[model samples]
Target chain A: MAAEHADSGFNIFPMDQFVIRPLFGNHGMTWYTPTNQALWMGIAIVAVVLLLVIGTRGRALVPSRTQSIAEVFYGFTYKMIEDINGKAGLKYFPVIMTLFTFVVFANILGLLPYSFTVTSQAAVTVFLALAVFLSVTIIGLVKNGPGFLKVFWISSAPLPLRPILAIIEVISYFVRPVSHSIRLMGNMMAGHAVIMVFAGFAGALGIFAVFPVVAIMAVYGLEVIVAFIQAYVFAILTVIYMNDALHPGGH
Target chain B: MASEQLMAGAGQIGEHAEGMPQLDFANYPNQWFWLVVTLLVLYVVISRIALPRIASVLAERQGAIARDIEQAETLKRQAVEAEEAYKKALADARAEAGRIVAEAKADIQKELDIATEAAEAEIAAKSNESELRIAEIRKGALDSIEAVARDTAGEIVKAIMPVAADQKAIDAAVTAKLKG
Candidate 1:
């Protein structure tokens, strides 16, 4: 029965469906289906909300297990903010923590079998990175006026070299969001693709599938760890970006 | 050939010409719809109800730590005061002991002085009494000697010479002998 089905070219696990396709014409880059990505995003959001509600609803001085876990996450983010930007950074706690929790849950959810990895798509990661970039830039400008431009220029070198170095600095500064978004998207996409390839191998190898199956299992576990690490890396980079915006100087 | 075969196998498994059930955001699965609804509810609850309570609890914890530190300071001060009082009491006890020892020594010295004075006075009074008795005995012995001498001379005169016993003679003889 399996040979008959195989001869008919009927694949049990569809891999091509994950491919990006163009939505429209003319400068319309190929992108993942928004529907699938949005569904995953919705799931991630719900997970975060459930965690917050349950964790915060019954807070005791000596916390419940859930509350303690939530507090640890909260404390970790709080410390990260404080360490990166000092006491003044506390004002951005809500946004930073929200972003951290959202991204982390989304990445972790992707590791589940049959779940869509929304963070694997460039569009979603780009949107997040661009949002962070625009907000930090605007905040810097608002806080420091036209002087915020000095963040890419005057802070790096002596006055005589400012004009020449400013061009290079500004170019690099603009590249920040691209690199940030691509880093997360690339890691997640590569990890998921590798896992899919391994899973497919297990199916293709038939009776001699023990090695492939073990390898796929090991890769799946690693993907779970990678998901969390990618989220943390994204959040940490966001903090560093915000710090540069706020400080303007290296100090 | 194998790739084509795999694609065919996948298509047969999927069955639907368009492939695995494509997600439609407009008409999401019931599970996802309910998940969104639950998430919206939770977001409201967290922003409105949960976050404020957590903030207050954190504030309370900070206040508790401050209170504990202040209470510890107060207890430390009280301990210092108690220690000072204890030291003062110990010092007073030592001083009192010294005073008691001094007083005892003085009392002993005073008793010793009085005893010495009383002993000296008794010795002087005994010496005076002994001297007075010696003088009286000496005077009595002298008088007795004179009386005996007078009686012996009178008898001597009566035996040796037949002379009448006259008061003038006897008195002259006693007087001459006493003088000699």
Candidate 2:
């Protein structure tokens, strides 16, 4: 990244923004100390509340602008939950909805000029992915009892290879959270960092900054799509995991 | 700003990536603390406030649309029913009018028959009276002609035979000639 910026002599500090710092001032680290991550995450929650709760306060049959937007998002998530996991899956809709709303808002707010992306940290995303993973596993175990293990035992495979495949399935199942967390964190961080690098270039390029600015706009557009897509992917994957727990299948 | 930071050491690239802050385990505790706090808040807001509100709005709209459609269907049904009633009434009225017209035609025919019978009777009575009056006139004219014949015969006899003929004979002869 620096080699490309050599002509402009611009050294971008894109990753520095991800650092969790004390919200009050430069102070020694403590768990109780409110950090920038907390501040932004709090803002993300407020943003969601504003969009959904306050936005649809009227509950008009003929929806207003904010009401329509809220209703559209609500209907989308509702349909997604109903279709992906079935009506029985709606029992866990609140958790899934909370996660989706958080991720979406975090990504969108992160795109704002100089706003911190809460989801960009592995610390945040990993916790969310782990929560989903643990919940689905527990639910599967609780609901299916010993039958939950049937998901790993592939009866269709040859007896000799069945155990090997089961081992692979267990490993892959455990690896889900790692991939889930990393995917969102990496995507969010990469998009923002790339934009920051381009913006850094535009800073030193003087009148010729139009090219980098255009690239930034294009990447920004792509990142917007990525943000929504990542949220959808995370939520849908959660539904799939729940489905597995609800009905453990083999091969 | 990065160049000044880079002057500190060649290995330290800049504040940008001089240290991978995302992997900084020291900051993880505080980040996790906030993550949990904010997540709780978001969950409360979404499940308690946002989700229900938005769900209700969507449901309300759906219900309104369904009600409107049902109302329109009912109205359509009513219109169809009204049209059926109108058609039935029109058919009934047409049948009644046809019956009335038939009855009126029968009544007019009866009145015409009665008037024709009365007029025919009056004409027949008047004809009978006129026939009687003609017979009487004919009888009167015959009597006058007989009287004149008798008188003329008597005079001719008196003049030719120089004697008066018998009255009874003259009358009988006139009567016979007239009958022949």
Candidate 3:
């Protein structure tokens, strides 16, 4: 096995896969340039449509196999919002469902060989987090007016401690997007990189590659679980933030 | 030697100045643009199409189940009512049969009483007619015996009497003897 690529030189750059490049011919990257990132995002969109749109086309009372899968995704997201955000937060279910489906699809799809993870990129996750953060903030402001600041006001604390608590709350509030975005991106990138590293070991270990191969299998299984869990975490955190925004007084 | 080569590869990449591509800012816009487009498309498709269809199907199934339960309930009630009606008819028939039996008994008794009375009246009339006939036969037998006795006395007296003496006296004596 080592002799397979021995002539090409012993090179295994795990980070090389993370490099963003144009999907087409080499050129200066532009904001609107269709990159591999865009291509993978497009694939994720297609996956979502196939599940949510085409899968449910029958609208059968007794669902088809694909339709049942589609409904499970729908019901799972619906219940997630309702449980964490409560009935009032149900109004924002579609947007949160979008975030969930996109992240989940990207995470799982990236597990395929030669596929780029859209969520593995900080820029994409940041955009997603910012969208949730911005929309929830504006919704709070518009729905609750000046009262939305109550989320940080900490009225339950002792009068003197209230000011300090409020400051802490405000800082934590602003830091939400940073942690939210990085958490997803870091998990995805770390898992993929570790798997790639193990694969490189398998390549270098030749006939004794069984050790790294087994390790890759174990990590790959763990990565599959992590992929779904990370998506769940992202969606659940979005619900919590939305809950905070919807009912700032409860903070 | 392999380890050395791997170490050199890592060090060379650190000097490449590209670092982690994720930290690179130049590709942000492309990722952001595509991400927003994908999210927007998902939101429209889900809210506009999928959610409502699922909700309607669930509601329809709920309604169908409820209707089926109602129909079954109605059928059960009708069955119960029919059973009650059948029981009532059965009871009525039993009572009707009992009344018919009593009426027949009464009619038979009345006819038996009338026939018994007629037989008794006929028996009484036959006995009265037989008694009248026996009384008339006894009276006739007594009259014959008296006539024979009177004739025998008169013969004896005529032979004995030699004297043609007083027919009037003889007649008076015979009448007086028979009377005595």
List, residue by residue over B32-142, the lDDT tens digit for candidate 3: 887788788878877888777766766777798899999999999999999999999999999999999999999999999999999999999999998999888887886
Cα-lDDT of candidate 3:
0.82
Rank by TM-score, highest first: 2, 3, 1
Q: How far is candidate 1 from the true structure (C-alpha RMSD, Å)?
A: 8.2
Candidate 3's displacement at residue A210, Å, is 1.8
Residue A17 of candidate 2: its Cα lDDT? 72
Chain A TM-score per model, please list them: 0.84, 0.92, 0.93
Q: Which lDDT tens digits does candidate 2 get at residues A1-251?
A: 55664655786767767766667755465667877778888889888888888888887778789878877777777788888778888887787888888899999998989788888988888989999899989988999899999889888888999899999999999999999999999999999989988988888889999999999999999999999999889888888887888778823
Clashing pairs in 1: A9-B8, A9-B9, A10-B8, A10-B9, A10-B10, A11-B9, A11-B10
Clashing pairs in 2: A13-B16
Collision count for each candidate, in order = 7, 1, 0
Provide TM-scores for the models: 0.70, 0.77, 0.72
Task: Report, in order, each candidate's fnat.
Answer: 0.10, 0.73, 0.66
Candidate 2 runs further than 4 Å off: A1-8, A154-168, B1-16, B113-180
Residue A1's lDDT in candidate 3: 33
A60-131 in candidate 3: lDDT tens per residue? 877899888988887898888887778998888878878898899999999999999988999988888888
